[model samples]
Target: MLKNLGTARSIFLVAGFALVMGLLGPMPAGADENCREVSLPDGSVKIICQDDGGDEGSGGPGGGGSGGGERTCEFNESEIACSSEFGVWDGRCYARVASPQPPKSTPVWEGNDDGVILECNPPGCVGGPAPCPDRSFYWSPTAPAAPGPSAEELAQRAVAAMNLTMGEIGSTPPASTSDPNAVGTIGLPIWLWIADRAENTVGPITREESDGGLTVAATGTLERTEWTLTSASGATVGAITCDGPNAAGTPYDGRNSAEPSPTCGFGADLNSSPGSLTLTGTAHWVVEWQGGGQSGQITVPPQSNSTQVRIGELQALLRN
Candidate 1:
């Protein structure tokens, strides 16, 4: 029996040793094939070399082989750690250093927590935000300044210069024939005198009061013979005797002196028929002195035979 047990035990022991050797192979050499490939949990793969040996695991090409297990990446505050070196890609950061990232672009519009829209231009790529386009809409051209004198002032000055007394006063019939009336008429003599020299003919008369001075103005034609002055003695004064251009003896067209002097002659006798003093004569005449503006004259006709002489007063008033 003992002899038989020894043979069986020898067989069993040999069989166990063969099984152990089959289960464990010898340590691989450095010269062995490197791991060719590896796969990560993220579904990415890598190649490794054979020389790294099966113990170091395998990945595709730089250290490519096969049979390495899956890898996982570990995340931390400073860096992202991985279960295996190949788990993190080349472009990714590791425990010690981080990879560079591209600059971020700014958005055109920003939103607040409440979801309201706001405008903003971020600095970076080109500099800052662009300015908004100009939006002005309306414009008006300036008006040119008005020209010349006001209408109102010109109208007033014009009305003040019109001649009316010449025709109105002289043409009126006496109040009564028996009254022996001697009413005089005043006028402007020439059209040229009125158009060019009327203002100059009359003395400078202002709106202001003068020191015991009076202004005399002539209207209508000077040749109408409408104006005269009588003395208190009941004598008739003749048409004014003017010197220079307006002189009585001098022709109407003749230019005598630079300034004209006009005088009046007196008429003789007085009528006591209806107790009226009939008088006829012209007294007032104006000549241009400083400026050659114009000249004026007042004429009177001879008294009617109904009255020998009549005394009348002469006066003048200015409008402007």
Candidate 2:
């Protein structure tokens, strides 16, 4: 016997398993006999409730049809009734789908979040002397149908879930290189890059989502980063698109500080703007996905990260 848990519920019976979706609500009288409880493969109990004939004539794609004419159809004709709103009448049994859908919280589709209906054969037939067979359902052919998102769309959603980002700008001179003064010489090469080349920032990051019996997964990688260096006055000074194997840019060690960055670098003008220089790095990402027996690549918006550094001129060089 299952206690009252939710007003409405959808049962997802699949691959040797079952999932029930519902919220807290009151159960009607006689609901005990109308519902059957089964133990899930995971040792959890799910209450499969029989659809009341109330939704009859609700009219829509998933709506319960006219009340009088076809309502006489029953699963076994003796113990179970076929007047449920979860399936259609197709002579032998209801042609249904055993597809997985994205949760409401992360909807792959635009604006529907009530939940999904677990379509079943024989309409109202859930549990009785003879129950629905396991995995005997067809794929969701028209449920999430046209106007619904495709595998590629789900892949895009998977990529979005990764929350990709660009890292703060890093420079060879190290913004704090001179403590209380200038950190770069007006004419010296200042190494530039997107700091912290990690999975989240410069990926090879992966994520996935399952729907309509297929699971779509996407992997994203940092393809390149475009860097723009501007003077304090907002005038462009230099630009470089880092597309090398190490596109994140190499950090500067003291040994190579004097030399221009072998990967990405720029020299300030002798008459550069009076104060700081703005360095901005925009990251480009390539996301590829495989699912639904197919695969493809996606283009996402670029992410930009920036930082400022103080550059000064050498008044009078005094060397021995």
Candidate 3:
């Protein structure tokens, strides 16, 4: 007896075969047609193949009719297990991209004149339990055929693969001033910046990902840094934002020691009493991607890093 298939059950059953072995390896070189490698959920591998005349003495859906006689085929509700890297689409599993290029006239590839995307269509088997696609590839112009998935989707995938981050917050006066007892003076400038600039942090870093024949590359650059200044008592006092190419801010050198920070700095009116002020710096990044004849921008979640600063009033001394 075979389970009823809601959709194209006959086609899938007629052409597909599952090894059902404990562990299977990749399809060997020069393998037979209508076969592809599949990875199972339990970290095991299996091979699914489409076979001609695979259906033998098996009852049709619900075990009603004889198997050897004329078999009826119809689409039914059935779970199609796709390979790890593939996705199910339009009642068929699709690879990331079509290998060869489908003609512009292809109904599915109508608007896309760009590049090639590979497609593997499922054929019919008489009464096979598991149905998979044939190894033969087709040209679909659009990867997985457009309107299904777009380059932007791939771009987001690349961004996720990046695992981006922001560096620690640095200050001009240093979190702990040279004179431990001498805290930052109120009404004076406090410079904030990225402590360390690296590939993953505050970076103009680039990354790329490839699948089938399609490739996408993305670059992330620091756009700005927003600062929140809070008093020791947890009261919100000031908010400073630094933007532009120097979002990371200029590290304090001996030069221009008296002037305010040219790029990213502000004067705090509040003073730290029992506890020190908390300066939290949030990094903003803009990621731009270009691939498949398209380019776009993306903004990732803000990364935050904090440092503590103590501010106090400078006492003056008068001489007789």
Candidate 4:
């Protein structure tokens, strides 16, 4: 049913699809029922062979297992047509991930270039992992569990690395400002000025699914509120409280009204020292994420995003 046309490297994808559809060969009656594989603990390596002619656990070098223990199989899923024939060679049942592929001159064989190509594809054994080719036999009494944290956990870690902020508060860039009102000085009405929101995402992170094999479902959420850490002379003055960040945010975002902000807007006392005028903004963030059947929440310590403003008395110039 399978035949080579011209060059071995010229294995057409259409031909592979044809074989899968039974266009070139009798579509295996029960498909996956016929994909029999067996492995034995022969030394460090085991034997793996596929027999479509027999029922499940019916054929192979040592016959398929009833327990069907788990094993690692790596393969380039995108290229199913380059199926290399699984053969017993040099003590191992097949070429391992460690064994480099036959050189390019051999023939565009398995993704790694082995010439012995198979005519059919195995059921549910299509893809795995990042991009790489691997399809070797493994022997175990029970399926092996993953060794590290789930994909969601990794995604949460990626999200935490972003260190997001809500721009700067007060002043133009939260630095030295010529306007006394933005600096919270005495006699002038000052309002909380928060910059635009700073948003971030670690992107289309991936995770392994128990059902349809490996599926991508990343998990992470970041929620934050703004508050000013108002202090003076290294002594506690007063806290702005955890007033909902929404009401305390953006006093200068084009609402062109002289209306006084009752939340975070106020004037410093004239008696307050001009020498140590400190206006700071503290952002409280609550991060929560869930993935791979597990969930967690992280309360990041508030720091780093606070801005420093240089306060100087605004002197008025008298003209004659």
Stretches of model 3 off by over 4 angstroms after superposition? 1-150, 177-182, 268-275
- The regions of model 2 sitting more than 4 angstroms off are 1-149, 176-182, 267-274, 317-320
Per-residue lDDT for 92-211 in model 2, tens only?
Answer: 334333355434343232244443433345443545433454313322325522222456778888988988888867885566433445367667777877677778787778998864
Stretches of candidate 1 exceeding 4 Å from the true structure: 1-140, 150-178, 181-204, 207-263, 267-320
What TM-score does structure 2 among the candidates reach?
Answer: 0.51
Model 4 ranges with Cα > 4 A deviation: 1-148, 171-174, 177-184, 187-189, 200-232, 242-248, 253-258, 266-273, 310-320
lDDT accuracy of residue 91 in candidate 2: 33
Please say which candidate is ahead in lDDT: 1 or 4: 4
lDDT of predicted model 1: 0.26
What C-alpha lDDT values do all the predictions have? 0.26, 0.58, 0.58, 0.38
Each candidate structure's TM-score, on Cα atoms with residue i matched to residue i, is 0.17, 0.51, 0.51, 0.40
lDDT of 4 at 140: 24
Which structure among the candidates has the greatest lDDT?
3
Please provide, for model 4 over 144-234, each residue's C-alpha lDDT reduced to its tens digit, 9 standing for 90 to 100. Answer: 2223333344545545565544445653223545443444343443456555444431112223222212122333223344444334556
How many residue pairs clash (N, CA or C atoms closer than 3 angstroms) in each of the candidate models, in the order given?
Answer: 51, 0, 19, 2
How far in Å is the alpha carbon of 313 misplaced in model 1?
25
**Candidate 2 weakest ten by summed lDDT:** 55-64
Worst 10 residues of 3 by lDDT: 57-66
